[model samples]
Target: MTSQIAAGLLICLCATAWRMMRSLPAWLRLATGAVLLAGLTAAVVQMVGSPLQPVFVATGAAAVVWEQVVVAAWWLLAARLLVEVLRSTLFNRGLAAKGRLQGDLLAGLIYLAAVLTVVDTVLDLPIRALLATSGVIAIVLGLALQSTLADVFSGIAVGIERPFNIGDRVWLEGPIEGVVDQVNWRSVRIRTDGGDIATVPHSVAAKSRVINRSVPTPQRSDSVRIPCAASVPPERVAELVRHALLLSPRILAQPQPAVALVRIGRRSNEYEIGFAVASSNDLWHAKSTLLEQVLRQFRSAGVETADRPGGGATSEPDPASGSRRFLAIPLFHDIADDQRERLCRQALSRSLEPGDALFRQGDTEGSLFFVASGVMEVTRTVGARSSSLGRIGAGDYIGEIGLLTGAPHAATITALTPSDVLELRKEHLAPLLAETPHLMHAFEASARRGQALFDRRVAASVGAETVPPGQLLARIRDYFRVHHVRPGPDAHAARRHPAAQANSPPGGD
Candidate 1:
């Protein structure tokens, strides 16, 4: 009867294990339960059926030890696998979905408890005595490991609060800046931009002053300092700095930009050009580009940036006086002084009140206009739908696209308020470009660059709604599974291809 009951129990356990294996992927579900059942059966048979037999007692004791080993191994392996899989899935879902280390710790504890329960049952241990002994040992260990315990508890608190996560750019109290590399039970890892890894204890990190550039938003504020001779007017310096920053594609428009006289050095007045960036990840790239553009503009204008150590002090040139005051416009800088003067004379200065229409959509591309002051609204009409592309402010040039390509005006340009514009007629621009072939190339290059900028903005707006490529591919794979599509010849071929197989590292046989 005992043999028959054991066989029945074994059959039932195997059938349950098979069902579980079929339900979950092999990698996700461990067969610990089946192993535990087999061990329990052997233990029961040895202990109850042949209690006084020395061989049965020895066999049961061995089986009990083996069961404990299996349980511990399974618990550790399953816990590790579960944490890794959950972390990966959650992280890929979104920034908000990332799992905290506290959850992982909790999973580990639960696995430990489950393994202990199995071992206690298999060995027929007295739970009350074991609990009493464990309590006494814990008390002694806790006193000896006060600091370690603090760190562990602090780690749990930090994980729960989540001041920052992996990939976050953070500046700690010591003003240490780095990207978060890892968050573990007792310490946090950060990778500094200088290519060094920083390991900060959780106890310190939990209470340290931290500035997370990736939290709230990834945007960061950056500043570019441009020094000028003390004599240059502050207002003029601010205007120049503002114009340069606005033209760059990388700089954000909202929150606008700020320019201030930061300091007065011994030889020069330093002005700080400050702007906000969309991401700290791209901060270096944006700063480099803005500085490059600013330098280019200053050089083109023939503006002296600073006084040399030995050179005599040079006073700022007056914009109103006859003394040559350079304008930083790219087009103006390209032409010769005499030609520029002629072009300036030929250009018409037009003023329009608010609500005035400068040019309607479909109008002939007759002339290009540069905004001298005030704002102009550029609106496009497609059938009944009308969209405002953007507003152009002072120092911004427009209508260049139509004038260059001879295409009809793509949008209507209307004055948002009283505005002044410098109109360069196509006829006047033609002769000047014809006289100077190199000038044509400069104008075309600038125009092309402007068009590319416009296209990028349009693309960014359109692409914002699209899903990431990886996510889309995952969804497609899931869809195939749901539809029960049989793997085709092409699928088999893809899997069997050398290129596909090459994704995994080569192994030496």
Candidate 2:
């Protein structure tokens, strides 16, 4: 009765553990099995402590059969536990392939040995004949599963060599560019950029050339070709393009982007902009951002590309060009057409080479600047600490607070690329505000919004509280010396341009 209870408990534990195979870690399950095995051994010892009676000889045979059955179960459980430990070790050492192909093969051999030992010793079977028949069956199965066995063996090789681990971004000869999601016995699974899972058979993958982009380094290098008219000097084109490449925040600057006149044609010259990004995932965004900056840079420098209808730089600046540029600004959008033209005409255009500083952090210059083209970086210094606030691009304006309320520039503005800034002094804007006193309120609100955005981008915890809304309006009135006029509910709404939102600094909100 004692042995029977022990065997029943052991069976129950095994069943419970097997059911929870996926839920429980292999080491935990192995520990549970080991405890049960120890308990079973104790129970067996207790059963053996008592001697059998002579009158119960017939019953003794039945008892022996029951003991054999229990011992056989113990051997099978031990074999499984051993396999679990080995599998765990293999995974820890990175020796196990995805899906445990090598571990599974080893487990099969261990299980086969356990079964053979049980048949020979526990069940008392004819071992020699069984072995001979099993050899023949193994041969037949091997022949039938030739391709499957090839994959299994190839997977084992992959486990040992470890060409690329799961989650590594790899490129195959099939022009397959994607991340490695899984490596099962039969195939390697790749998740493409388009979110499709592609399965390549292990046999085929073994033969194909693979490039592991994730290994060594994750940075990927790419280039864009811009064609300019043969009339434009390559040196000028190269300098403009190099500055444009540097303007993009996505493109890495450490390796230093390269610009070269790679191809020359009778009608046009093609320059290649070579740059590297943090990863292949950033390639598209970096390329697009660089191209946009290049277009802005070329336009600002009066350079023309081959694709443009005129094939050469504008010989003379248009009279209305300044007005057109100013009209695009949201603050000047609502002003009368005549007012905009006069203001733009009076505005002074300042050209800055790369790394030029428009103003330093503590500059008290009470002036507004509009980004005509190219990109500029905004940085602020508070005491001993200096940090980048963000970047401002074309169609964006800066120095609003300084221009409106005579507030000192809170941040330093510097040219990241070849930039053209249109500087507007108080005298230039005075007439417009004089005619429309309500424009004071619009200017105040825009400045407030920009300051709030700058504060948040710096960090919420360290951000300083902005000036009160009414106080800012009052300050603007005092600075401009204009009488207060009630602004309409939607006075600022009609002045907003859709493109301004996208082209604004990082803190567009």
Candidate 3:
């Protein structure tokens, strides 16, 4: 009779467990159902109603022990299933929700509660007593680990407040600047422009004053200070600086650019050229192109910059005290003064009349041209269609990509107006490359930058009318006016003008 009752109880348990399994999630159902089946099998084996001798009862008792083991296994499996379900649900909801920081914290708390619930229910423990004890322990731990606790709480606060998000350029209290990589429970990870990763404790990050460059709008006004020789009129310097920034592709157009004479020093006058940029990531590149343009413009205009006492002579002057110091483009500023001088020397001046073709698309690459006086249009012909790539103006370089790759010119270069250009041949670059492998990296980097700009312009023009060859010339002219600069004269005239020659150092004497 007892054996029959045991078998009936096993059947009932198996049915109930199967129902539970069907009601559960797919992953949980498989794990929990397997455990329940093992338990039912053990219970059935232990049934004493089977017609057997005393030895059979002893064997049945051993099977009862196995049933207990199965029950314990079922509890473990149930706990595991609960944890996984809670984790998955919390993670999915947290990530999908809009306020990332708030969602993450809430999700973590939910996970913690779910874990505790699983422990209490599956293990059949008295949770209230454990909770009371944990509260007391937590208070003691909080006092002892003040800083760590602060960090954890601060991390939570960061999620809730969200001063910055991933990919934001932030300046923290320590004056450290970087793009926020992630926000975690204890710390925030930032990857600096130098490619170094910094882990800042959430406590510090939360309390510290942070400048979120990516917030509200990613655009920010940036300034570069260049010292001009006192000989150059301050008004002309300002105009020149403003014009240089306008020609740069990196400068934002909506805000417009401004230049001011910040201070006058013994050897030079310091000027600040201010402009807005679309992003902090573009800051370095924009500044580099700006400086290059400024130097080229100043040189073409017969303006002399302050020189370093030894051989590292620069074209800009030092500003007086109390003047706002401008930021220099980091990488380009690292080039030795001698290399820049060699580059200037190796460059050959040329002038192109309007309608002149500098090179066709299939022409062999020879030298890269840097615009020194006027505007040129770059066009690519693919199949029967011809598309305008972009316009090159004073200080912009062309043909570097093909020169480096030893490929035919990808685009046809034509003079949009009477233009001036400084040509740097591959042979002249060999000595520079041999002396500094770093220059090669710079050239390659510049080429990649040019390609990126080309890609962006091409993408923006997609679906628009294919800009006619004449329309391209008109567009180039419009771009110049919008930037507040006009092409002055042909390259040959600019080079031979009395003003340019007057600024030349006395060599015949």
Best by lDDT: 2
TM-score of each: 0.55, 0.80, 0.52
User: Which lDDT tens digits does candidate 2 get at residues 390-450?
Assistant: 6766545666666676766667777877777788877777766775676676666555555
List runs of model 1 lying over 4 Å from the truth. 1-100, 115-154, 166-169, 172-182, 186-209, 244-257, 265-267, 285-303, 307-345, 350-360, 370-379, 384-406, 412-421, 429-509
Indicate the worst ten consecutive residues by lDDT in candidate 3: 320-329
User: Residue by residue across 111-220, what tens digits does model 3's lDDT show?
Assistant: 57645654554344688888999999999998999998888888877776777777788999887899888776678888988999999998888879999997789897
For all candidates, the clash counts are 0, 0, 8
Assess each prediction's global lDDT (C-alpha) against the native: 0.59, 0.71, 0.59
Top-down TM-score ranking: 2, 1, 3
On residues 116-145, what C-alpha lDDT tens digit does candidate 1 reach at each position? 664464445788898899999999999999
lDDT of 1 at 490: 42
Clashes of 3: 8
